[model samples]
Target: MADVVIIGGGITGLLSAHYLAAEGAVVTLVERGECFREASWAGGGILAPMHPWRYADSINELVFESESLYPALCEQLQEKTGIDCELQVSGMLQLALAPEDEILARQWCERRSRVCEVLDQAQLQNLNILSTQFSHALLMPETQQIRNPRLGKALLAALQTNPAVTLHTQTEVNVIETEPLRVVTDHGVVSAGKVLVCAGAWTSRLIAEYSSLQIKPVKGEMLLLKAEPGLLPYMLMCHGRYMIPRADGHILVGSTQQDSGFDKTLNVETAQLLQQHAQDVVPALEGAPVVRHWSGLRPATNDELPFVGSLPDRPDIYVCGGHFRNGLAMGPASALRIARQIVAS
Candidate 1:
């Protein structure tokens, strides 16, 4: 039996395994599908929350802590795994704001002591890639992003090389039994001293009898466009959708939130709508070829803040999930906290 059994292999699970192993705990990480194929690989990897001021302080606390940890984390991952996660400080430009939004943004920046510069349409036009239709825009110079897929690869490689971690891919966990702290899976039952569920959308189903944890699967679709490097120097967000530019001339235009349960089927109409949104913001991308289109499910909680603690009655069973759209931004800190709790116990 392993010291810890993690029931998911997404960012949360992988990071938790990384931390627990560092604390001399033997971890068994199980994944239903290939690791990182879910929301962890599908996300845009924005280091900051979409709008830091819009969310509760709890959400901001985890995200900012993870943001601060990313620089050193990515460096260590690359040093160990020989894979660059492409972590970069690409600023974010927010457009199409209301009068009150501008004021709120400024106030939030002041309170947080973060950079928030307001620019008019003319000043935005000077950037060349953005459409000059919006009255003003907010420039957040400290925002950072990573190539999520690359980050997944790097983390997986690091764990695979670690002696304290055991990985099981394509392993479906049917139920979790707390009396003996064992996981019933397709292959066989694995006993553990402690179990941590970072299963994302499938978290509620696994521990349905243990607690009433409601984690809904929110579907999000994205389109990838190939463009010239430096064409768009920063990430752009308007309404709820955004375009994230990569260091390698690939731009990600995403996404739409729909209550689609666990179904991941792609919709042609949805893709067209996403393309239209992308072209509307950057006219230069009007003729850009959409190289790829994909969809993933984000796990949303009732209170919007992630559940990062143990179950109500089960001290041996813990959870670090329901991060919704901010999973990548919050994964590091959430996993670190949960691992520390398990180790101390």
Candidate 2:
């Protein structure tokens, strides 16, 4: 029996295992599929909350804390695991395509007290401005991003080499029992003092009767395009659509949030629409070749906030899932918080 049994392999579960083992807990992680291959690897990796003032208080809290911690955390991961997560501080440009949206964005910035520069049409033209001109733009200079796949690879390698942590891939948890404080699996039973249900999109179905969290799978479709490095220099977001440029000249444009239950297949029509969004933002990307198209299920809750506390009836069983699109943005701090909660409990 390990000290902790975590049920999921996405960023949430893997990071939970990382923090727990770092704190000297015997941890075991079970994954239904490959580790770090879900929404964690599929995200844009922006450390800041998308539309900060529009998000719920829970996301805002984790977003701010994670933004402060990501720099040091990425540095340590690279030094220890020899994997460069490409944590870049390139900042973000939020577009207000409509007059009303620009007004709302300015008001939201004021309400949140976030550092932002309200740019006029001339100022917006000076930047790598979108093709179709809008009212103005909101410049958030402190916004940061990471190469999500690299970060996922780094975390997985760190766990694989850690002697204190045990990993099980292609493993499924059959049922969970409270009194015995153990999870029954097709592979075997895992007994632990604490069991965290960070199973991403599978949380609600897995623990529906055990907990009150109604987690649903929201499918997000994204596409990658090969462009010149300077084609789209910074991240551009307008009307919930975004394009992020990588150091190697590849830009990932995404995504469409569909209530598609557990389906991970990529739709070409949806991918084409995302590609069009990239082209609309940066006309140079119109020539960029299509590289890859993928989709990942974001675990969404009723309130769009993650259930991070222990269960009401079962103090030993905790939950840290349903982060929706902010999973990558809030992952690190969420893990640390869950670790402390478990240790203190």
Alpha carbon lDDT of residue 60, candidate 2?
Answer: 81
Clashing residue pairs in candidate 1 are none
lDDT of each: 0.91, 0.84
Q: How does residue 197 of candidate 1 score in lDDT? A: 97
Per-candidate total of colliding backbone pairs = 0, 0
Give lDDT for model 1.
Answer: 0.91
Q: Write the per-residue lDDT of candidate 2 for residues 1-345, one digit (tens) a residue.
A: 889999998899988998999888989998988998888888888787667766777788898788788888888889889999999977788886466766666776677676778777787766663675566677877788999889888898989989979999999987888778888888888887889998888887778767777999999888989977876656888878988888998888888999979988888789878887777767767767999998888999988888898988778889998899899899989999999899887
Pick out the ten consecutive residues of candidate 1 with the lowest summed lDDT.
127-136
Off by over 4 Å in 1: none
lDDT for each residue of candidate 1 in 238-316, tens digit (9 for 90 to 100): 9888999999899999998989899999999988988899889999988899899999999998887799989998889
Best by lDDT: 1
